[model samples]
Target: MEILQSAAALQAQTEKWRREGQRIGLVPTMGALHDGHLRLVQAAAAENDVVVVSIFVNPTQFNNPDDFRLYPRLPEADAALLGPAGCTALFLPSVEEMYPEQSKLRFDFGSLEQVMEGAHRPGHFNGVATVVSKLFHLSRPHRAYFGQKDLQQVAIIRQLVADLSFDLELITFPTVREADGLAMSSRNRRLSVEARKKAPQLYKALQLGVRLLEENRPVASVKNEVLQFLAMEEAITLEYFEIADARTLQTVEELTQPQEVALCIAAWLAEVRLIDNLLISAKSL
Candidate 1:
């Protein structure tokens, strides 16, 4: 696979591909490749003639500077994994190349940015939108792929596409998970052995919440039960456990109507924060 680090080189290459009538697919990521990330690349490859995966640990997206500094980086390993997974190009740009000048613009998604991740991590989605918008422009792909692991992020990007009129199809695959059910993430690498063992509890808690909701239980009761369950796990510090409309991500108090609902949770597994969610349809319940 071609490893590109400069904007000019990437744009030129993509332009050449465009001139040659090749369908392009873009998968934006922050390095530290795992099966989940590769799944996105494979999905992109299946439908497009060329798949471009961009790996730049976007500094703006991190609410905690320590989180930004501690985020994993494994370019060589990531490239090795991507090349065999059908990636055609890797846009591994440095922070300076990506943000040649300080950004003065900020994005506000109204109600969408007022809950869950947005509420917990202030200005997080703005940074996400900024970098994702940059990737969408730079790659100029016919389609872009993302994992459902980042449920809220997927929702935000969907809105970003509609609001900004970006000409690309957004495809999201199911969240990939480990054998024990922890959602696969780059941050998973930082988990200590004990912490990793307890990490699956997040997924377990989501499962429990889903069961209760599916049984027609009250939203408030389900949340309380889930919270109590997590509290029993001494290593896990719960941040937020929300049941919300899957599309708008607005917190819901009841599942009285047939609609898609997301059971999203964020918690600290020791020092590393982990997030997971389950999407269920009230109709099915």
Candidate 2:
């Protein structure tokens, strides 16, 4: 697999592929490769003639300076895994390369940025939208792959594509998980043994919430039950647990007309903050 470090080089190569009538796929990631990330690459490889994986820990996306500092970055290790996953090229750009000049523009995603991750991290989604918009333009792929673990980000990107009228398809793969059900993440590496054991409880709580919803329980009650479930687990501290419309992402009090919805949660297990979600059709209840 080829490793590219500049937008010009990546665009040049992809242009060649386009001339040859080859479909290009792009997977944007923040460099700590885990099974979940590889799963995205695997899906891209299955559908596209060329798969480009971009690994740049976007500095603009982090609201907390310390979290930015602590974010894991192992390009060599990430490349080692991608080499075997059939990736065609790795767009490994520097911060300056990505943000040639300090960007003064900010994206207003309307209500989409008013809740969940946006509420907690002020300019976080703006940074995500900016960097992702850059990657989409740079790679110019026919399709892009994202994981469902980041449910909110997936919604934002979908809107980004529609609003910008990007001609590529956005594909979302299911969240890859551990044998015991914990969602796989780069941050999972920082969890201590005990926190690791308690980590699966996050998924378990989501599962319980799903069951409650399926059983015709009220949306508000289901949320409380999930919160209580997590509270009982002493190792986990609830940050936010929301049951909202999957598309609009607005918290719903009642499952009135069987809309598509997601149960999303963010919590702290020790110093490691984990997020997970489950999507379901409330009509199926």
lDDT winner: 1
TM-score of each: 0.99, 0.97
Candidate 1 lands at a TM-score of 0.99
lDDT per residue for candidate 2 within 1-285, as digits (tens), equals: 999998899889988999999999999999899998998898899999999999999999898888888888899999999978979999999998988899999898989989998888899999999999999888899999999999989999999999999999999999999999999898898899999989999999999999999899998788888888888999898889999899999999999765998999999998778999999996798
Q: List ranges where model 2 is wrong by over 4 Å.
A: none
RMSD vs true structure, all candidates: 0.7, 1.0
In terms of TM-score, the best-performing candidate is: 1
Name the 10 consecutive residues with the lowest summed lDDT in model 1: 250-259
**Runs in model 1 lying further than 4 Å from the true structure:** none
